[model samples]
Target chain A: MVRFENVGMRYGLGPEVLRDISFHLQPGSFHFLTGPTGAGKSSLLKLLALSHRPSRGLITLFNKEVSSLARDDLPAMRRKIGVVFQDFRLLDHLSALENVALPLKIAGAKNSQIYQHVAELLEWVGLGRQVDAKPPTLSGGEKQRVAIARAVINRPQLLIADEPTGSMDAEMGLRLMYLFQELNKIGTTVVVATHDLGLIKRFGNPVMFLKDGMLTTRKQDELPSQFSRDGG
Target chain B: MMQIIGKSAELQLEKDVSTRYLPVVIAAMIFLAALAIGGLFSLSNAISDWSATLTGNLTVEIAFDPTADLDKKVTDAVELLSKTPGVAAARAIEQEETLKLLEPFLGRNAALGDLPIPRLIEVIIDEDSAIDLAALNEKLGEAVAGARLDIHRPWLDKMVLLGRSVQILAAAIMLLIGAVTVIIVIFAVRTGLIMHAEVIQVLHLIGARDQYIAEQFQNYFARLSFLGALPGLIVAIIVMFIFNFLVGSLEASMLPPLSLGVEGIIALLLLPLMVALLTRFTVRRVVLGSLERMM
Candidate 1:
């Protein structure tokens, strides 16, 4: 669950990049965040993932205000959530299996449990044969899948992917979306940001549209397409 | 069977490529440090041996007198020393032996028989004796005219002070070398951190503890320090043995043998271990400090 009220953010001495943003997400909910380039969508997701401190406003996560949490306490809170970066920030020195096993190791899972769960998950993600391959040797789509596997390996309660399939073909993007959708079906809250309108129609998750740092919902009456839906 | 296990210590992000230079830096620092410490210990032991000899001895010199018989005067001084309460033994140095003692300043074949060299009476005293030098000098003067008592205590004091000063200087140099080692390690760790920053950032984002990340770097540097210091220590000891083999006899006549006793050997053997721990500590601090800046 996340709540942001009047949240504004900026780098030092710069004009505000995200201004007066307020949104709410209930537990076990799914939403698609849509915006054109330079729409501040990534900045907003950063605030949600607790990676950046907002210049002003209240952001609450899991019913507790994030600004009030101590730095030492942030890791435990972060471990509860998963994030997929646009760059698929996999460690190049690590093989695909090691990269996927990172979250479990950080969580102090036993070695045997990590091996078993990570192997099974990599096999499920179509990276079964590339488990020993490093990121530099893996294809773009394979790296993306490794990133997704690492993100969800711990079954994080809140899963966020920023441009998860941005570099993939249409079918590959759809297949990755199905992976996220499968995670959602298993009751993991999912939020994905992308510019793909066709994929939006295919998935049919309610869209949260952002332009010039402001968020608005697309209602059924306002939509030109037949799939407009209610949003929470 | 072909899975990559994610042990942070096995992460080669920082250890790769830097191995070529890090060991060389550590080895050079260690070599200088070991040489300084070895010389310091050797000087300290030699000074103690010299001090003990000086503490337990004195000398009586009878000036060469043409009017009086010089041998009789030297004999009288030796007789008096033998009868003295705290005197242990007294013997007159033969003219030939005195000529050999002066060979450094005078030519080996110089005619010393024609020159007016003092007749020397060597005196050994009981270590625990409380003999008063002024009273003993008065008694020796009354026994033989112009017989001078040289107690060696004040000269020993000055020599001891000079030896201490040298030890202090050697210790200061050793400490400077140690500081240089720390700085080198700091620079090395910083470079490694910069090269591996991406891996570290990903690790941090994945919720790894600062200590968990630091262990990877710390273990790497500790092992490097241990291995690097080994060659330096080995080379330094080898140099020591070779130098002694070449000039050992000449040096032994001037001072005690330059040997590392039990304590010195233990300290030498432990140098590499201490270097390892120091490197580990320095690297851990740098890693944590840099991570704290990130936060």
Candidate 2:
């Protein structure tokens, strides 16, 4: 679960990129965050991920006020959540399987256990043949799938994805969304930020729309046909 | 602790492309650095022992007054030297022994029966004796007038000063070498961090602790420095032994021969360990500092 109350963020002396944002998500909830270009979707996801502190306002995750958490304690909280970066952010020097197994490894999982889970996840993502390949050798879609596998490898309580399907084709994008849905059904809270409205419409979830640094919450049914087909 | 080991292993795997060569390099550096420091220490110690053996005993030379009774003057000087406080033993040097002392510089056949060499008395001081030169000089001067007593103070002082200077110079050189090692390790760690920025970012994003990340680099650098320093140390030791043998063969009375005894060898043995410890501290500090800045 996550709650942000009147949150505001800026990079150094720059103007506020996210202003007066407020939202709350119940445990096990699924939502789609839709926004135009430069609408601060990534910034919001960063806040939820505990990567950057909010410049102002209260931000809570798992019922604990994150703004009050110590820096040393932040990692423990972050370990319970998973993030899929738009850039995939796979270590180019590491193999695809190694990249996916990173979270488990950081969590101090046993090698045998990690290998087993990672192998199954890579196979599930259809990367079994390319498990030993580095990111430079893998295609964008394959990398994205690797990133997704890494995100879910730890079975995190909360999953945050920023443009999870942005670099993939229509089929791959749909299949990735199906993965998120499956995760949500298994009690993992999923919050996905994407510009693709077609995928959002195909699998409707509660929507949070952002424009010009402001967010407006709306039920999935409230989106107009055109906007629902292709996010604004 | 187990978790840290696991994480380190994972990181090593992740950085296999570069880290594969790092351990061998580190081991070799450690060995060389140890060997070099050991050799330097051994040389310094040998110089110290050689200087000590030469200057440890005081020498008293009695110049015979030709006008006086030579045997009587010799007997009186010996009696006075023996009674002086801190005089372990004083005896007149035999004619043959005196000639032997001069053989090295004057050559075996340079001196003949015609040359007049001053009769000298050799004084050996006890290890615990504290020779009072002013008192001994007054007593010996009065006992046999015009019979000068050479305590070898001027030359002894010079040797002591020279020995001390060598020690200080060696220490300064070691300090400079340590500073250079620190600088080199810092640069290496910084370059490694920069080259692996993406990997670091990914690791950080996945909730890896900064200490965990730093340990990986620390281990890598500790290994590399230790390896590189090993060969350098070995070569230094070899050079030191060779110098010791050459100096020993020369057998110069003014310059004592070098010796690597038990104490000297012990000090040399500690060199590699010291180098390894130094490398560990330097690399760890640099890696942690760089990681903190990167974060």
Q: What is the alpha-carbon lDDT of model 2 when measured against the actual structure?
A: 0.75
* Candidate with maximal TM-score: 1
Pairs that collide in candidate 1 are none
Instruction: Estimate the TM-score of every prediction.
Output: 0.86, 0.83
TM-score of chain B of each: 0.82, 0.78
- lDDT (0 to 1) per candidate: 0.83, 0.75
Candidate 1 Cα misplacement greater than 4 A, ranges? A220-232, B1-11, B14-19, B63-87, B92-117, B127-147, B249-258
RMSD value for candidate 2? 4.4
lDDT (tens digit, per residue) of candidate 1 on A1-232: 8899999999788988898988898888889887667778998988878778899999999888988987787777788788898999888878999889998988899999998899999999999988999999988888999999999998888999999889798888989999998999898889999877777777778878877778888742343342233321
lDDT of 2 at A133: 99
The i-RMS of candidate 2 is 2.1
Expressed as tens digits, the lDDT of each residue in B122-215 for candidate 1 is 8898888887878999999988999999878788888889889988998999889889889988988898888878777767767777787788
DockQ score for model 1, please?
A: 0.45
